[model samples]
Target: MSRKEQIEKTATALFKSKGFSATSMRDLANALGIEAASIYSHIKSKEEILQRVCFNMAREFFEAIDAVEAKEGNATDRLKRAIAAHVNVLTQNTEASAVFLHEWRHLSEPMHGTYLSLRDKYEARFREIIRSGMNNGEFTVPDEKFAALTILSSLNWIHTWYKPEGKMTPAEIAHNLTEMLLNGLTSSKQALHDTYSHLNTP
Candidate 1:
């Protein structure tokens, strides 16, 4: 990895474990087996490292949503894919996920605004999918934002409790989450039929 990548990797772990304020330049330098001042060669300050870590996580989050959005399918399928991709990336990248979930609030005003803007953009992807599903008569949610938030909240919480090596594989977890979210948001006959078939089977 490049020096900047190494710095981000190390900083992500430290920030997740120690939080932004509790972690220091000396801590990162010590962890990387370099002098405190050597870190300055790669990054201007500790805040820069935090910014990179946050940006890295944001990039991953948006990329996952983009991948799902680019898929060829109905809005429901796209939403399912998006939820699965979100969980897969967050669970597989624990440090980045943690940095995203817990450390984003530490960014300065300008940086925080930038982060929030990207976050809103990414979230709009989900809301758009939900709205499309509703307009097509595939979903029956009363509030689009609340429904989208419901799905996002469920998927976002995977970073907190999901384990890559746990009993369920990523595909299984994703399917369960997609099913959970879709069921709550949509009351279409097709969805009810699928649920009935699954629930009544031997």
Candidate 2:
């Protein structure tokens, strides 16, 4: 890898562990066995690294959503596609993604505002997908916002515990998560008992 790429990679890990505010140029350089002053040749500032990590990961998620949305599929299939894409991105780029998820608040002025707006636009995509499902009689939810937020909340949490050496691959994790969100945990045998029959009564 190039010197700049090595610096960025080390910076990403530091940002994930110590946060953008807590990590210093010295910390990054020390991790690379180089003088802190030398890193400036490649990066202008700490925020620059944060911006690179945050915006690049954001671009990835936007691309994933765009790809999923463009495909020919039912609402259920589209949601599954989206979930898989999300998990895959997180698992593949864990450190940078963690920074994107947790350290973005440290961004300055116009960038902070821009990031928030971008995030809202991204979330709106989820709301539309859920609404589409309801319109097509494929999904039933009391509120579109709530359902979208719940799914996103669950999916984002995976980044905290996901491991490259873990039992589940990214695709398998996404499959189980999608199944839990759509079909729920009730097995066929348990569902047949109709224990909650009163809830279904007219």
Candidate 3:
């Protein structure tokens, strides 16, 4: 990694563990085994690091959803892909994901608003998918907004408990989770049975 990338990576770890407010440039520099002055060469401020981490994570999520949206599939299949994509992004970028999930509250004014806007857009993509499903008679949810919130709330905190060395891969976890979430929205017993059986299969 270049100096800039290395600084961002180390800062993300610090922000994840120590928090953006609690972590200083000195601490980040120390973690990088360099003088505090050296860090300034690569990063302008600790908030800069936070901004990079937050925006990069947001971009990743948007990209993942964009891929799912572009694919040709039924609502169930599209939603499954979306769930898997989300899990993969979180697991693959755990440290940054943690910082993004928890530390973003510390971001300054305009950037904070920008982050919130991006987040809303991301959530809207999920809601759109769920609404599409409901329209097609694939989902029986009474409220698309509530269903979207439920799915996002369930998946958003995986970084809190997910272990890289766990028995289940991200894809496996996504499969099981998508199955469970979809079960609640599925319109009929046959759909639920099919999902249940597929989830149980080796």
Candidate 4:
């Protein structure tokens, strides 16, 4: 791989495994089996790597939300699509998701603000969908923002414990999660019963 790619890949692994505050340029270089000075030939500094990893993960997450939000469908279906997309991205890009989860706090103030902006934009897409559902009497949530956060938090944390080599594929996990989230949010009694029974018995 090229030096830049190598740095990024190596940095991603270190950041995810060691966390942002704990990882150093020398650590990354040691992991890459290269001289510390060699990294400077391709990348500027450690913070730059932090920026790259954070921005790359943020871009993927924001893009997925945008893609789902732009689709033509009813609010409920669109919400399900959004949840599925979130789970898929979190599961498929495990390292990126881990970086996003663990190293986000290392970003600079301005970059942190930018990151929050993109995140809020994504959350607003869900809020909009939930708002539409409530307007149509399909959802009964009192606070759209809180409900959206709750739903997103439930899906976002799956990466922390999801095993790529486990019995359930990403699709299966997404389906089960989506069904549970939407059924609770939309008050689907039958779906809720099925979900509860499946979880309880299995």
Q: Listing every candidate in turn, what is its Cα RMSD in Å to the true structure after a full C-alpha superposition?
A: 5.0, 3.6, 5.9, 6.1
lDDT of each: 0.83, 0.86, 0.90, 0.83
Runs in model 2 deviating more than 4 A are 184-202
Cα displacement (angstroms), candidate 4, residue 107, comes to 1.0
Per-residue lDDT over 117-152 for candidate 1, one digit per residue giving the tens place of the 0 to 100 score = 988888788889888988887887778888888887
Q: In candidate 1, which residue ranges exceed 4 Å CA deviation?
A: 187-202
| Candidate 2 residue pairs that clash | none
lDDT of 3 by residue, 92-138 (tens): 98899999988999999999999999999988989999899889878
Measured against the true structure, the TM-scores of the candidates, in listed sequence, are: 0.86, 0.90, 0.89, 0.88
Residue 164 shift from truth in candidate 1, angstroms? 2.6
Badly placed stretches (over 4 Å) of model 4 are 188-202
User: Taking the tens digit of each residue's C-alpha lDDT, what string does model 4 give over 57-167?
Assistant: 778777887898777988888888888888888887777788887788788889888887877887888899999988886777769999999998888788778898899
Identify the superior model by TM-score, candidate 1 or candidate 4. Answer: 4
Once fitted onto the true fold, the runs of candidate 3 whose alpha carbons sit more than 4 angstroms away are 187-202
Best by TM-score: 2
Native-vs-model 4 lDDT?
0.83
**lDDT at position 18, candidate 4:** 86
Task: Give me the displacement of residue 166 in model 1, in angstroms.
Answer: 1.8
TM-score of 3: 0.89
